[model samples]
Target: MSGEGDTPQAIRKLSPGRLVIASHNAGKVREIAELLGPYGIEPVSAGELDLPEPEETGTTFVANAELKALQAADLSGLPALADDSGLCVDALGGDPGIFSARWAGDAKDFDLAMRLVEDRLNEEPDMPRAAHFVCALALAWPDGHVEWFEGRVDGTLVWPPRGGNGFGYDAMFLPIGGEQTFGEMDAAAKHAISHRADAFRQLVAAVL
Candidate 1:
């Protein structure tokens, strides 16, 4: 695997005008596109190219993000940006880290996953069921140059999910410095303080 400063032999440099976002999720793509727009880069999604999904076998967020970015760059012949994000609950011993997406099994039943989180913490009652969302972003050039950034938001989990705006664990996550859950906030509001947005800021700084 390529480490810091050691460019991959297979990758090539990204051109100046456009960028490819290595994700299939429309929500993620839209957010990233908006974030990168001010930098004057036209963002394209892997979903638009009908690219094959890359398997995320890496143990850490950085590893997974790099894996996806490299794969997308190779396939699309463009610079690719990828991110891996998940909620890590302290009460569960940081479980559901990488498995956050599969917590409710392969069906991706988020409702069941949220219920499971509640069930696991119900008995704790007074115990602090704190959690945090982590986002790791990777930017890979077709020529093998890659960089990564990480961002995290500490928060506690709410019992009954609230709001209907955001996706995943948004309804159950109350950020450390916020009064409402992410789902309770509008997209612009949530993006202003989200872990993904934090990471994206770093990405923009590096790229621009």
Candidate 2:
């Protein structure tokens, strides 16, 4: 027999019912809700439930995601799902990976954050503009059970950002082999190939 943390227990399947989306960001909540649309799971955001935003003290996306999910599950007394995502710039050694949102400041001013990223890249004039988006999703039950899934999408950083369709660093990120940045793509288009979508695919396969 193995310890609870290390035991290879069967993956828990989510029953169709109310689920808490453990996040306050409207963009993230909307995206997640859309992805969960076909699953028959009723999704409610943490903001809607007046849940406090948990301080993300974890160093990695996985840690932060699990932290949020568990907190929501414990507070709401329902199964909860959380996502922790960030942009990792190759030239900057994956800087802002877990602190992506913090760079936007308290106002959630991503324009300032995007400018900062561009300015940093300017300092390294010769370095490649390669970057990637990472998303970690954690699903937790009130009883302390959890499952994790992660995804990544590689791309390059563009200058002047692009469209206003998506949020965060979406405007500056051009997916590999794609001309339009994520900010330029419509929700459905972006959803088809985003890091979040990638993670959702894995979750769907395992537990949805």
Candidate 3:
């Protein structure tokens, strides 16, 4: 298992240039753009290039992120970055990790997903509601040189949800040491202490 500062021995440094974000998700693209803003590199989305969303065949978040990045890099002949993130509830035995998107159904209805989570948990009220968000970032070059990092933030689920500032499961998750749910926090505040931010910090250290 890898932890912070534990760089993958196979990973190498990458020079900043035109990079493609391998995702159709608008929010993800925006968040990544913000993260890379300081580096002053041109960030383009796969959607912008009309790239197809590849099947997420990988079973784990890291593998899925790498798969997407490498696919986009190969298609665009440029450096590509990808992120696979999810909410893992301990009570659910880390479920909805890779299938987080699927939980939203084909309609991408996260409201239904959240309701499902609540309904399922209602069946087992004795179980803990502890959960965490996991994010895996993969950076791949056209030639297939890859660097990846994983980050996670611990928190607990709050019933009835709170706030409307974030998407997906943010409204129901209250991070450890935080007074409000992620959905209640503003962008700057959320970015300052998010799982993606942690993964970005690791990737920057490993291969910026």
Candidate 4:
């Protein structure tokens, strides 16, 4: 993965202009679009492009994000942004770190993933099961300049997953300072204090 210093300041100097968000996930695309809305950047989603989903072969969030962003930029000949996010659990030794999405195999079976988390922690009732959602955002320009930003919200896992608002692990994860899981919060509420929102703040500082 490229270090923070590797990013060219020239990339930041470029106008916001039209930007492409390289993600097929509608939820992610919507969240990112909302975050970038204030900047007056016209955001387009990869799902709307009929582009092939690039394989995420990178080992880290930043790597994956950069890979996707660069690929999209090259494909569309436009500046692109990409984010890679996942939940990491302490008690599980981060078993689902990069594999968070595929924990239940290749079907993207999130229900099974939630069940696995519960089953894994069932034996260790006394274990301190702290977890966090991590988001890494990468901005790639057509000229190969790239920048990265990261944000995370530390929280703990709750069983029997509550709420039905957000997707994936949101139903089972509570932010550090909150009692309700992210899934319990409304979209506006979740966006106000989400890991993705934090990362977007950093991205705004760098680009806007």
Off by over 4 Å in 1: 1-16, 123-125
- Which numbered prediction scores highest in TM-score against the true structure? 2
Which parts of model 3 are misplaced by more than 4 Å?
1-11
Sort every candidate by TM-score, greatest first.
Answer: 2, 3, 4, 1
Give all TM-scores, in the order shown: 0.89, 0.95, 0.94, 0.92
Q: In lDDT terms, which candidate is top? A: 2
Error of 3 at 187 (Å): 1.1
Taking the candidates one at a time, how many backbone clashes does each contain?
Answer: 5, 0, 0, 0
Is 1 or 3 the stronger prediction by lDDT? 3
What lDDT would candidate 4 get against the real structure? 0.84
Model 2 lDDT tens row, 1-208: 1122342232789999999999999999999999999999999999999999999998889889999999999999999999999999999999889999999999999999999988898885587899999998889999998888888999999989999998999999999999999999999999999999998998898887
lDDT of 1: 0.82
Residue-level lDDT of model 3, residues 51-107, one tens digit each, is: 999999988898899889999999999999999999998888787888888999998
**For model 1, how does the per-residue alpha-carbon lDDT over 1-208 read when each residue is reduced to its tens digit?**
3453443232333346767899887767887887776666888899889988888999888889999999998888888899898899998888688778778677767889899888878767676789999998888877767877788888999978999877778899999878999989988888899999888776665556
